[model samples]
Target: MLPIRECVEQTSGYIPGEQPRTNDFIKLNTNENPYPPPLEIFEGLQQELTKVRLYPDPVSTQLRKAAAKVFGVSSVNILAGNGSDDILNIAVRTFVNPGETVTFLDLTYSLYETIARVHGASVIKIPTDNRFAINQPIICPKAKLIFIASPNPPVGKHLNRDYLEETCERATGIVLIDEAYADFSDENHLDFLNKYDNVIISRTMSKSYSIAGMRVGFGIASIPIIEQMNKVKDSYNLDRIAQLLGTNAFNFQEYFKVIWQKVRQTRSHLIESLKALDFLVFDSDSNFVFASSQWIPASELYKKLKERKILVRYFENPRIKDYVRISVGTDQEIARLLEVINEIKSGQEFT
Candidate 1:
C-alpha cells in the first residue's frame, strides 16, 4: 500500500463554496463582488497577452511596485501571489515546521486549518466570543505562526485595532492579519508593519476590487518576511495577465471608488431590509452580511433560496449553523432576495 502522511490521511481538505456551472442562479454564496473590472483592466490584459509567449516576470515587479504605491509601502515590502490564498500557503511553508502549530480564529476562514494540516503542522483554533470577537489569549504561546482574518468569515465581525496590536505584542510567532476585506472597512492595520517586525498583512483584489477571477492578492510586510515568503512561492505564481490586470486596476483608482461606493450602498440597504424582516444581522465591514432568521433555520432558508436560483453560504459548524452569509449583490438582485424572504414568511405558519 502506498503510504500517505498521517496529517494528509486524517484531514479533509478545504472545500470552497459551490460554484454552480448553471448561469440561471444569482451567485451570492461566495463573497464575490457584484461588479465587473474597469475597462482598463481588460485592455491591459489584452495588450499583455501578446507577450504571453515569454514567461511572465517571475518576480511580478511591476505589480509589486503598483501595489506598493497604493499600500504606501516600499516595493521590497510587498509580495504578489496568484491570490491571497497562495500567500497563506507560502507563509505556512516558510514559517511553520512539521511539528509546530499554526493558529487562527475558530470560526474564521476554513482554509487556514487545511493549510496547516497540509504543512504537517498542528492547528490551534481559538474560539471567538458570541459577538465574534477573537479571543487572542487562547492562542498557544509556542505557535510558529498565526493567521487572523479581520471581518472574519461566516460572521463578518472585525478585530479591534487595539486588540490586533496586543496580539502582535504578545505573540512569539509571526502574526499574519488577513485583510482580504480591508477595502470595505473604515480602518486597516498596515501601519502596524512599521512597529512590529513579526506582523504581516495580506490583502486581496478579489472582494471590493471586483476582480476575483483575475486571481491577484498580495502581502505587505517587512522586507525580510517578504523575502522568505518569496523563496517558498512558485516562481511563476502570478501570470503575465494577472500582473498586467492588477497593475491596471490600481492605476484606475476612481473606477474602484465608484464600484465600492455602490457595494456599500447596497450593503447598507440590505442590512436595513434584513433587520425589517426580524433577522439578527451582524455589523459587517465586508461585502457580505451574516444574518440569522428567527422564523426559519439557516439550512431551510438556504434550500429555499437555492430553489429560487439564489445561492448563499451556510456552514454546518456549531458556531455558524444558525446563520446564512449573504453577499451584497446589485440593487435589483438584493430586492429580489428580500421579496422571496417576505413571501416565505407570509406563507409559513407561526411555530
Candidate 2:
C-alpha cells in the first residue's frame, strides 16, 4: 500500500452536499444563492481572462483593499483565501500544533473536526442543548484553536453573543468565528475583532454574492493573526480571475443586498410551509432551515424527495436523524418544493 500519514488514513473526510449531474432537478441541498451575481462580476472576469497565463497576486492585495473599504477595516486586518475553507485550514495549520486540542459546538460544520483530525490535533466537542444552544462553557482552557459558526449549519441557529464574548474573554485559544452564512443572519461578530485580539471572523462570497463557483473568501482579524495565517496559506491561493471577480463583487453591495433580502423573504415562507406539514422547524438566521418531523423518518423523506428530483440535505448522525436541511431557494423553486412536500405528505408511504 502507498504510504500515508496514520491520521489521514484513519479519517473519514468531510462529505459535502450532493450535486446532481443534470439541471432537471430543483436543488435545495447545498446552501448556494439561487440568484445570479451582478453583471459587473462577469464583466470584470472577461477583462481578466487574459491574465490567466500569469500568476495571481499572491496576497490578493486589491481584493483585500476592496473588502477592507466595505468592512471599514484596514487591508492589513484582512487576509484573502481561495474560500473561507482555506482560511479555516490556514488557522488550523498556523495556530494548532500537532497533538494540541481544537474545539467547537458539537453539531457545527463537520469540517472543523475533519480538518483538525487531518492535522493531527485532538478535538473537544462542546455540547449543546436540544434547542442547539451551548449548554457548557465554550472556553476550553487547553484548546489552542476554537471554531464557532454563527448562524451555524444543520440547525442555522445563531449562538448567543454574550456567550461568544465570554468565550473570547476566557478561552486560552484563538476563537475563529466561521461566519460563512453571516450575510443571511441578523448580526455578525466582526465587532468582536476590536474588543478581542484572539478573535477571527471569516466570511465567504459563496452564499450572498452568488459566487460559489469563484471560491472567494476573507479572514478578518488582528493584523498579527492575519499575518501569520497569510504565511501558512498557499502561495497565490486566489487565482487571477477569482481576485478580479471577488474585488468587483464588493463594488455591487447594494445590488447584493437586494438578493439577500429576497432569500430572507423566501426563507420565511419555507419555514411556514414546513410547519404546516408538521415539521418542527428551527428559527433560522442562515439561508437554510433545519426541520425535524415526527410523522416520518428523515431518511424516508430524503429518499422520496430524491425520487421526485428535489434535493435537500439529510444527516444520518443520530442527534439530527429526524431532521432535514432545506436551502432557501428562489420563490418559484420553493413553491415547487412545498408542492412536492405536500404530495409526499399525502402519499402516506413515508409514514
Candidate 3:
C-alpha cells in the first residue's frame, strides 16, 4: 500500500449533521430554509434540462453577473462555486501555503478546522468571548487566513460592522466572512469590501434562497483576490443547471423576499415562544434560535423530540451541550414543536 501524508493520516474530517432520508420527522437539524425556492428556479431548471449533454460554463459567467448585480459589485468581484463549502476550500488553497496557519472561530461551522487540515495547514481555534462574540484582535493578527461566520452557527451571534472593520484593518492575511445567514439579518459587511482588499464575504443559496440541493454559492471580494481564486478553481465548478437556476432566483428578488419574510416571522414567533417557556434563548439574527434549559438535559430533550417525529440539532461540545439549535419552520410546524415541548415539560412524552 502507498503511504499517506502525515496530515492526511491524522485529520478528523468534517461531519455534516445527519440528513435523515425518512419523512417521518419534522427535520430541523440543518439550518435549511423552510420555504421552497421561487417558481422561477424550477422553470429555469426545466428549461435547462435539454442542455445537460453539454458541459456547464467553466467560468459561470451568467451566474456571476447575476450575483454581481444583486450585490452591487462588478462580475470580476464575484466567483461562483459548487457550494460555499467549495469556496471555503478554494480560500484555503488560494491563500494558505502548505504548513501555514488558518484561523476559525472555536465553535463555528466545525468544517473550517477540517478544511484546514485537509489543505495541510495548521488550525487555530480562536475562542469566542463569554457572549459568543468573535474576539477579532486575538484572531486576526496571527493567521494567514481567518474564516468567521457572521451570525455564527450554533450560537447565531453576529459580529458587528465595527468589529469586522477593525479585524480587516489589523489582519495580515485574507478575512473571509461566511454570511450563510446574512439574508436573515439586517447587518451586513458588503460595503467593507470597498475599503479593504483582504475582506471576502461568501454566501450560499442553501439557507435563504432555498436551494441547498442546487449547491450554489458565491464569494464577493476585491477583484484581485477573486481573480486569484478564479485561477485555482476547477473550470466547471458550477454546473449548467445551477447557473441557470441561480440566476433566475437572483432575478426574482421579490419572490425570495416573500419567503424570507415568512422565515423571519416564524423565527420571531419561535424565539418568543421558547422564552415564554422559560428556555434561555440567545439573541439570534439567523433563521434558527439557540435555546437552553436545565429542566431537561439537551440530549434527553432531543431524544424526546425525536420520538415525537421532530428533529433538532444538539451539539455535543460542552459549551453548547445543554442547548439545542432549532431551525424556524412553518408557523404550524413551530406551533406543534411548542406544543410538544410543553407536553414534555408536563412529563408526557409524545412517542
Candidate 4:
C-alpha cells in the first residue's frame, strides 16, 4: 500500500464543479465570468516572456501596491497568493495547530472543511437557519480559526452583519472572511478589519476580474497577520505572469465596474425567470442564483440540462438536493437557458 498521511488517507477531497471538455456547451456549472478579460491586460505579455526564465518577485510588491491602491489599504496590509485557495491553506497552516478546531457555516464553501481536514485540524460545521442564515453568534471557544464565506456558495445568501460583528467580538480566534463573491455583493466586512485585530478578508481575481486562469488572490489583514501568513506562503506565490496580469487587472476596475453592473442586471433577470418557471429561487447577492423546482428533482433537471449541453451545479447533499445553482452568464446565454427550461417544463424531451 502507498504510504500517505493519515489525514489525507481518511479524507475524500473536495469535488469541484464540472468543467466540460468541449466548448460546445453553455457552461453555468462553475461560477466563472462569461466575459473575456480586458484587451489591455494582454498587450504587454509578449514583452514579459523573457522574465519568465527568472524567478518572480518574491514579495509581489508591485501587485500588492496596485491591489492596495484599489482596495484603499496600504501595501503593508496586502499579501498576494497563487489564488485564494492558497491563502486559505496558508491561514489554516499559520494559525491552527494539528488538533485545533476550525469552524465555518454549514453548506457554505465545502472547501473550508476540506482544507482543515487535510491539515489535521478538527472541523465544526455550524448549522444555518432554514433560509440559510445563522441567527446565533458563531463562536467556538476552542477554535483557532473560523472561515466565513460571505455571500456563501451553493446558495448566494449573505451572512448577517450583526451576527458576524458579534462573532468577532466574542470569539477568541482569527475570523477569515472568504470574500470571493464580494465583488458581486452590495456590502462586505472590510470594516471589521479596522475594528478587530484578528479579522482577515481573502479576495480572488477569479470571479470579478475575469482572471481565473491567472490564479491571483490576495489576503487583506493587519500587518502582523499578513506577516505570519507570508511566512507560510510559497517563496514566489504569485508568478511573473500572474503578478503582471493582476496588477493590470486592478488598474482597469472602471472597465470591470460596467461588467459588474451587467452581471447584476443579468442576475436579477435570472431570479425572475426562475421564479416565472415556478422554481423556488433565493434572493442572490452573488453572481449566481440558487433555485429548486417542485415539478422535477434537481438531479433530473441537471441531467436534462446537460443532455442539452447546458450545465449548472447540483449538489447531492440532502439538505439542498432539490436545488441547482446556476451561474449568471451573458444575456444571450441566459436566454437560451430559460428557453430550454421552458421546454422542459412543457414536458418536451430532447434526444
Question: Model-by-model lDDT, in order?
Answer: 0.87, 0.90, 0.86, 0.90
lDDT of 1 by residue, 1-351 (tens): 112387888888888889998899988889899988877677756667788789999989999999999999999999899899998999999999887889888778889999888778888888788888865553469789989998788667678777788889888989999999878877788889989999989999998777888899998899899999989999899988888888888988888888888888999999999999989998788899999999899999999999999999988888789999999999989999999999888877653
Off-target runs (Cα >4 Å) in candidate 2 are 1-4, 349-351
The total number of steric clashes, by the backbone 3 Å criterion, in model 3 comes to 0
How many clashes in each candidate?
Answer: 0, 0, 0, 0
For residue 118, what is the lDDT in candidate 1? 73
Per-model TM-score on C-alpha atoms? 0.96, 0.97, 0.95, 0.97
User: The CA-based lDDT of model 3 is what?
Assistant: 0.86
C-alpha-based local distance difference test score of model 4 = 0.90
Return the TM-score for candidate 4, rounded to 2 decimals. Answer: 0.97
Model 3: per-residue Cα lDDT over 1-351, one tens digit each: 112377777888777777888887788888888878756567766667888999988988888899988999999999899989999999999999877889887778888988888778877888888777765554446589999898898778787667777878888999999999989878788998999999999999988888888899988999889989998998789888888888888988888888888888888889888988879998888999999965888999999999999999988888889899999888888999999999998784334
Please list all clashing residue pairs in model 3, or write none if there are none. none
Query: lDDT tens string, model 4, 186-217?
Result: 79888899999999999999999999989999
By lDDT, highest first, what's the ranking? Answer: 4, 2, 1, 3
Q: Per-residue lDDT tens digits of candidate 2, residues 217-236?
A: 99999989998998899988
Model 2 / residue 117 / CA error / Å: 0.3
As a whole number from 0 to 100, the lDDT of residue 238 in candidate 2 is 92
Better of 1 and 2 by lDDT: 2
